[model samples]
Target: MDWDKLRIFHAVAEAGSLTHAGDQLHLSQSAVSRQIRALEESLDTTLFRRHARGLILTEQGELLFEATRSMARRLETTAARIRDSEDEVFGDLRVTTTMGFGALWLAPRLPRLFERYPNLRLELMLEERIVDLPMREADLAIRMKEPSQADLIRRRIMEVRIRLYASRTYVEREGLPRTVEDLVSRRLIVQNPASPQVRAGGEFVQPLVAQANSTLTVNTYFGILQGVIHGVGIGSLPDYITAGFPDLVQVLPGLESAAIPVYLAYVQELRHNKRVCAFRDFVLEEITAHLRTIAPASE
Candidate 1:
């Protein structure tokens, strides 16, 4: 019922220790303990079970924590919207994308963003999990497929295909695979089965990896790219990478996977946010530049 008490309870529940929660709330441990006791009295329910290790949430506590967490997320979203100045593209901008694309493509081009808006603070979340943009888990997302989540504005940024590639030196030394069958005699480098990747990439890699006599499997595309660059073996890599690593020769070019659509998405609420607009435009400009650079090679 009391917002202040609810806030304190949420912090304590999250930290699982009164002392730790006190450190975060800038209150004394005894004061935090008193607040928890008062909250329990008001609710007439034990929220936590004490143990030697730490505090564990009771069933009622879990329910209350979930509600409080949702409240926190909503408050954060509101605060972000309020901080978005009409004329200035500044403040925190959280962007989520796959590890490979974030590290390989977006990270390299971020300097241009900072040069334009030095006051902007960017948080890059590179992982495979699809964060909830509408719920404000992340401000924006660059995903391998279109986001099906409602109340979000999404734009198809580009398409990518998983194709076989190897360094020029490796292609010259071992020769290119004339057919998929030829891979049986050569080592193949690929993303491990457990790695989180687009369905197209996974499908393209399995058959080639199956036929190889020797194989090196890495969890991330960045690792697979490294292996290919060092001549470890032929690798299944996204075609976008070729723009940056032009010397990497395509192998069995005819054998490639279906196109994976890449989408840039954000909550509809952020449509007018200057920071969001600036970032969206920046990404489109970069993608256009990349396409132009690779046009001659493709032709």
Candidate 2:
């Protein structure tokens, strides 16, 4: 029941040796062994199985280690919250989103955020895997679909669609197609049909890939964008990417995928945290500005 003993047990279990754990804790091996013995006495259970090579946890030790690991994560979260100044926005903020958006949109705009709060540190995780916000896998997430996970505070931020684009140089050389059928004569660049992407994008991509005279398939939208930018071919890319790339000419203005809703979410506990709120506000403002620029006539 002693917190200090539990701490020592955690370290010993992690290190798998009393001597190693002792070195880390600034205690001698004898002292570390004494504490573990006391903890085992209090719990009436063996925590580890000694081996010639090292140590391995017993069944009981695994259970205790699970609790300790959870405790460690929660403690880190608590410490981060405590570090925040209610009136100031500056600290380590982990933000997760799709690779395409992170690389093309959010990452480029982050400099302004830094200018406003020089102390603000950001960890941008760009992946398809949905991070567990409540469990603190990430401090916040910007995802293509609404997060169905629990204990999350979510806001619908924007809508995006897969659309066709090509570099101005390509358009000048190959000429722009006026209709879907017109694309049959041109080289079509797109996301690989096998890659994990939004349903709308995947659906839109299949038909185009099937009929083009020539094709280039990239695994990511970033790769497709590069091909389009460098005049490789007409590429299918998310519309939001165009906000930052003015040189990319929309090949067929009328052709696009159904709108995919984008959501920004965080653990409910972070709703009032200064750094979280500041980052959320900054993103919303940027999204608004982006929407205005992308669809000025609609607005």
Candidate 3:
């Protein structure tokens, strides 16, 4: 029940080694071990399984760790909220989105964010998995589909399509695929079936992979973009990326998947958090500005 003991336990669980946790806490290993033992005795439950290499969480430890993780996130959110000023947006804001959008769209525009809010500490989590917004796995998320998570404020950003693209050089070298039938003779670059991807993208890529004579599978959209840019082959890519990457040309112009909506979401408790508001505003503004430049050409 002691806050200090919970903090120490959280640190040790995260580090997976008493000595490492002690190093972080600036306490001797013996002192850290004693505290852990005392805490376990108080709880009357073993929290960790001792091993030669390091400790592993027991069932009870896992439950406690989850609780502590939530506690830590809530504390951080509270601290950030308290630190926020109407005049300045400064503090940590963890943002999650798919790897493709993070690497292809968001990452490049981040410099403007830093320029405006120099004190902001931004953590960009680029993965396909949905981070828990209410649980504070991340402060905000830009996702390909509407988030079903409760207790969140959600905004629909825009629609995107998965379509084939190839470099001009590749098209020149291999000739453009006039139809899905034409794709049979050319190498298809796609996200690997094993990798998590948006449903639209998976649908667009699956048929290409099945019909192509040769195929190259990359684990992420970033890798697929690299392959397409380097003249590797035609690829299944998000239509949004074409706005940033000028060299990529849409292949088989008639072919693309149904529109998928992009959404930005945050916990309702963060409604007044300056950092989250700033980021949300910046993203909405950027989308508006870029769509103007991209629309005429994209159409």
Candidate 4:
């Protein structure tokens, strides 16, 4: 029947009264009651039972309510998609990434994006927390972990290798750790000691002693690399961050290593947006081309 009648019926079912539904829909109370009456007549069923305070849904009304809710949700999603399509793509591109990668790698590369699209603005949120893309918390994100949800589209950018490193001065003073057992006694700068993934074997690398006895504890990879530069204790750092540093030497070259996959994620529906597509392709191209030069050879 009439969509407007169904709309009014849905509103009244939700609000429990004609007056309340009228207030919500910005219609007169009489208009709300008329629409509900028409809908009831069209359906040939008594949708609501009259009560002293308000109305209560009948069994048929309850069933209709569930179906109507689904319809409303689908309609709202479709309308939002249409509106987003009609909107211009010259707005800000909000991106979220880890602090270390954002600062050390992506921040420097953003100049090219700005140069290409002078009209678009870029806002970077550098935090470890994964921002919700479908909720519009962020337009895009570069994450170290693979996404578990199927609603978003994920593209693997590259395979990242973590290498243990120390400065030449530290190596000379503390003596280089030739074996994994030697690493246990030596000082180490850990990024996140609390992380289960950071543990090698049964012994956890204590950053406090590693800092006091050897170097320092830092949360970001950039900070760890800097600590290693100033002759801090040995630390594990991503290959991309330490690529150009002259003083940082690979510690325990073959014995100890961990590799993690990096991904570029975005909402599946937004993939077709012109600006989004352009940025996605550009990033994919850059990462694919540069990964060979920067990524460490797989062990």
Q: Pick the candidate with the highest lDDT.
A: 1
- lDDT of model 2 at residue 30? 97
Candidate 1 TM-score, C-alpha based:
0.71
Badly placed stretches (over 4 Å) of model 1 are 1-87
Stronger candidate by lDDT (1 vs 3): 1
Per-residue lDDT value at 295 in model 2: 81
Q: What local distance difference test score does each model get?
A: 0.91, 0.89, 0.90, 0.75
lDDT of 2 by residue, 25-141 (tens): 999999999999999999999999989979899999999999998998899887876786566677799999999999999988999999887888889999988888988989999
TM-score of each: 0.71, 0.71, 0.71, 0.60
Worst lDDT run of 10 residues, candidate 1, spans 81-90
lDDT of 3 by residue, 1-299 (tens): 98898999999999999999999999989998988899999999999998988999999999999999999999998887787657887778899999889988999999999999998999999988998898899999999989999999999998888889999888788888788898899888898998887778788778778878899999988898899999988888887787787878888776889899999999999998888999999999999998898788667
List candidate 2 stretches off by more than 4 Å: 1-84, 297-299
User: Which order, best to worst by lDDT?
Assistant: 1, 3, 2, 4
Number of backbone collisions per candidate: 0, 0, 0, 0
Q: Model 4: runs farther than 4 Å from truth?
A: 1-89, 168-175, 195-215, 295-299
Model 2 has a clash total of 0
